[model samples]
Target: MERTAPRPPPAVDPLRYRWVILGVATFTQAATAFFVQGIGAMGVHLQRDLDISTAQLGLLLSAAQFAPLLGFLVAGELLDRYNERWIVGTGATVVAAGLLLGSTAPGYASLLLVLLLVGAGYSTIQPGGTKSVASWFDPSRRGFAMGIRQAGLPLGAALSSAALPFLAGATSWRATLLAGGLVALLGAAVFMVFYRRPPHVTVPEDGPHLSLGAQLAARFGMVREPSMRKVLLSGLSLISVQCGVGILTVLYLYEKASLEAGAATLVLVASLGAGVAGRIVLAAWSDRVASRYTCVMTCMIAVIAGMAVLMTPLGREPVPASLTFVWLGFFGLGWYGPWLAYLTESAPPGKVGFALGMVMAVNQIAIVLVPPTLGLLKDLTGSYTPAWAVLTALTLATLAATAPAVAAVVSRQGLRRRPPYS
Candidate 1:
């Protein structure tokens, strides 16, 4: 009998594949989040162009968030059962196409409808891209890997915040959306072409796919786990702070700090750039220290400190205010790096997608409720103080709730000994 020829190996080395996945995950994440985050930067233009109130503009951001409340769960389940490359790539395509179609939107209502579609597509990117990166890196380096991937959001947002206002000024809001859509499509193509599952992540053919009831039950069951409860609660309080910071930074600077529109937007871009750096640095620190919760606690402390500064009269001083907002941007967004790493580490085996989905889905509730509420508060009170104070209290609450977990990690000398999912 003739022997068959030996199978050729893949072009990239297995050892280097994880980094390649990280790069793709990062780009896709940045691309998917670009338009929504850019919306915050374009607030004044949207108000003038669309002739809508602050509340209505807030609603636009809220609209993008609304769909993720449920979409996250569905995407999570699909990720557990499907290939991430296609799920993520397809989702990005949807976002691009939706925005392309949205460019033709006739009114604020039509734009809202278009944003709804963008959110649906975004629902896939968080869990799918995260799960894909998590699969490639073991716990030892997962935090660092995840941080790099998550940084994509802020990095993309920073770039968009810096560019979209100019684009809108030169062209039209519709044209800006068209430009963002094109970037998102490019991201989708990159992810589809380059991403590959790790060799160790083979799916078993014999096991039955999770039934809907079983999947729902599994998700509910995650809520009951003690560690998961802490993670969920931490996310609940922390996400409000994150959303408030993201949505209100430019507005707050323009209105309260007496900055011109261009200067305020420049400040917003700088803050998001800080956030990009913060995610990577904080997550890398978590990996080195092997204490995800400690890193989270550190971030909470930083946020509280930053918020306290914001609450004072001194925070309104132009130079101080810009510095302070960037400080908050660091911790507010930085917390997510370690937070997500801990969440992934805590997940039960084969359930990273579900855990990430459920936790982030619940977090999305805060994202939905908080920004608009803060916007309304700003509208009603004619001040950002109430919003900043509320965020400060929320951060305090999250720190208090997560104390026990952080203490446990500290007691262990800041090292996790086992796979949290196991």
Candidate 2:
């Protein structure tokens, strides 16, 4: 009989595979973020067991954020040079290692050091995941895809918020660190095993690579653009609100609203749950709207309203306080989806990773500083009201500064045909 040709393997579908990438990216994001996101949930335990003040508690959280200040810039540069699968997977592994080490921490200072290492690892995930999603999805679906991917943060946060406190309450705070490490290890393994770059994209081997100084100059130049400046401002302001809410929600409810610890934690969970939903809904809405920036602005307005409500007499009541926090969570956390999509769209050609890294690095200044500042305000004033007032005023000031620029951009876009991404 005549020999038959061996059958060729079936080809993978790019469209179907993109969803796989999305799932992996989202899962890895959630897993890597599990411990950090749960810090707020552990506030009561950390304060009780460590015998630390609120400022110290805030400092503990800030420790995890501090390394990301410089790490994001480095990670961004790496993303532009390397494959995300390895960068993100390795980052998650580092997070696992840091958390595992943190479990053995003898005191507040040691825990802070461990979390600083964890923050270094976490710096890779945000820009790496954003760049990966943006590469797969075009403008029309980018916002929605970005939204789903970004939702992983709050999804992980919500799960951690619900689980960590219970774990800490049942065992000890150290056990919660161990649990977070294991989860991060699992996430790292999944991404390393499954993630692959889109098959169609190619890296050019013949192009001249820039020197370190030149590359740094080019990345810094992005800051000079009006649009980028706006993004930086918005990120700084809104992230302060986000961190404030996460750091203070349970404490505020427990101390000011007269709720029990368990009840206060449940409210934090509800707020994070709202954030997950808001990210998806608002990003999808951005897809239909004239501008993604509009969605971000809407979030700003909503956050201001929520904070204003929290400052009122009604915030003292359990029902009203819970409802208002949920509202704050929705807009404050949800804003990241549309805002990231906007940032990705705003990047100059061939520099998405660098732009993300640079802008996010600038934002980290707020993330690191705000938590401690808010905590100190609460400590000095002996009230949560001053902290809330500060966040409200910061956000309001940013809105006022950026409104005219955003409005002009919107008006200009309205007069012309809408771009696919914008």
Candidate 3:
């Protein structure tokens, strides 16, 4: 039997043409990230306009998890087996509908419905975009590509930070939220038209193709492969902390400190600007670092440490809030990129979407659980200390436990898979 020559690699300057596809994907995610993170910026306004308690406000901000929390397992599996363009594009549309609903919503119940819809929409962006990008890029360049891609979150957050406050005043927060939805919807349309996997690549013909349940099983199997778990653990820890801060910090400023809403929101904007810097810098840092695993571990440690500094008397003290936001922005958001890189490297074939979606799922769970628990703590105790302590504990414990989990899995796998007679 004659062997066929290997298919030529796809075009080198993916930039000239492919970048549009990539950019569309990035912008969709950027839209979602901006809206999700900016809920904190809307904190003071939402509370006053709706007559909801702090706990209820927290529920509204955190409520955007319904889709991801419920739909993500399937979403991940779908991205792996199907063409990503439509998967993600549809997700963006779902998010847009939620945002459109939210803009006109009259009360908390309606707000909850819109947020749940939004979360569902946003969930598809990660797995779908990541699966598509991974198919196009090689491992060596994947980190850089993914870093640029992942910066979508920070970029989106920055845009939201800049736009939300101003738009809210001019047209109401409702209008601003709708603006975000429109952005995602636009990206989705662009994606559906332009985005397709490079045609040169081939899937195993005999293996599963686009079977939702089977793909999910494959993803679950991939995650069980110890190295992949390390990546997942790192992601779960980092994103939980990031979302916790993103959802709560602005309210913390107003409720704990005497800062006016305007002052508090500006501080959040500054912090988000710092986050944009942190994402880029840390992404670059991973390129220089010897081990993706170590870089992720180190960043998680730094972030946990940074959160402690933010919990200081600085809130009540005359110390500069800007300085604290800077530190938090660097140390808090910095953990994201390295861990994302680790995940991109470690996730198994056909399961990158699953891994990323799972990481996102953990983040959303944190989003759902953290703010309300914090709100409850405040409701009961009249302080933010308990919420801070809970997150600190969550980060510290996860950071410590992750290393050993990785080690155990690696050791067991090494023992199981070594050559029979080495």
Candidate 4:
């Protein structure tokens, strides 16, 4: 055989490589979150198989969120100290292990325990992925990039909602869990093998290293800034609405709107699909706007409008109700893109991880509390209307509280004559 020269590997463009980073980050997010996000979709199946009530089903979803309450703080510190590749990959691995173990659980209690384990793993993913994408992209394109990355959430939920329920119906809920684990494992493998820090960036070693305690204290101190307060407030309120939509959508449609179970789940899937689109569109819009916060506020206004519509008699009509929920899904879930972009841009230099963790940790309070509270409210009232009303009131309150601060921030930015990200 004639000797032939080997072909050199094709050169990867440094500028275009960030898209790869975005793809990996997004896939990792969706993969790791598959099972947890699908729990709501499995609610009807879980209640039947596990003999649990709606409140208990809500608890099941809440179980996975509980550990992240404290885990985000620790994960935040680790992200600041270490590389995101390992941080996010390990977290996804933990999620895989948790879900795989969960497939063997005999009852609701055991499943909750397993989900708690999953939550511990998931705590690292949100902030770590946010930091990774933010590091790869600059201010001008950052909002759109962050939006695309964040869209993985609804994308995951949408896929799971469509597939998991059918899997549960055909085989068992356990099979659905097993599938989620396998997907998450794949996500971990891909991210670990492929992800890299931006090559040109270097960590500054000039500053004196603060002890963990001092660093934590400094992170907590960020809460005092007016901008940070707005982030916290919006995160808390909007997350509650998001969780409400996830936990209650199918149930409300099936029970109150008198839709068939399958039809209700399809609506849930459609709503999540809308959310996926909303995140991308709103985020791209944020990049051109003077303030990313403005985009966030626009989402809140749209959600409020949707909630108001849901409170009326027309909300019971299948077409009108489904349309309203889809509308809510758009702004309610879409808000995170611009919101996270605003958060990343507002963080103190070299402390983006800490800021992400702090706000997410605070947001966890609502995540942990809202689902069960909404479930319980539905139980008490025998109506989903009150729950929707509560979400509307909460969002309105957040907007009212933050309006002055937003105005102040916008005024300052205008006076400085700088771009929003600057």
Give the TM-scores of the predictions, in the order they appear.
Answer: 0.89, 0.88, 0.80, 0.89
- Please state the error at residue 60 of candidate 1 in Å: 2.4
* lDDT by residue for model 3 (130-242), tens: 76766775544555556677777876766676678677767776887788778767877877877877756554322646585764465567766767766666665666666
Using TM-score, give the best candidate's number. 1
lDDT of candidates 1 onward, in order:
0.84, 0.87, 0.69, 0.86
**lDDT tens readout by residue for model 1, 1-422:** 99999989656765688889999999888887888888977988999999999778878977888888899988887787789988899999999999999889898999999999999999999999889988888777788888888888888776887799889988899998898899889989999999988878855331467776875786678777767887887787778888888778877788778999789878877887888889889987887665677788888889889888988998888889999989988888887888898898888877778788888899988877887799789889988889989988887887887787668766877454534421
What are the per-residue Cα lDDT tens digits for candidate 2 across 284-386? 7787777788888899999989988888999899999999999988899999988998999888767778899999999889877787788889989898989
Off by over 4 Å in 4: 1-12, 44-55, 105-109, 204-211, 254-261, 415-422
Q: Which predicted model would earn the best lDDT?
A: 2
Residue range with the least summed lDDT across 10 consecutive positions in model 4: 413-422
Which regions of candidate 2 deviate over 4 angstroms? 1-10, 43-58, 102-110, 168-174, 204-210, 255-261, 415-422
Residue-level lDDT tens digits of model 4 in 1-422: 99999998666665688899899999998999998888877878989999999768867877888888888888877887788999999999999999999899888888889999999999999999999999988777888898899988888777887789899999999998899999999999998988888876555431467875776677788888878888998898899999999878888888778999889878888888889888998988888877888888898889899988888988888999999889988898999998999999898877788788888999999977887799889989898889999999999998999887778877877733225542
For every candidate in turn, the CA RMSD to the true structure comes to: 3.3, 3.6, 6.6, 4.3
Which candidate, 1 or 2, has the higher TM-score?
1
> In model 2, which residue pairs have backbone atoms overlapping below 3 Å?
none
Q: Give the clash total for candidate 1.
A: 0
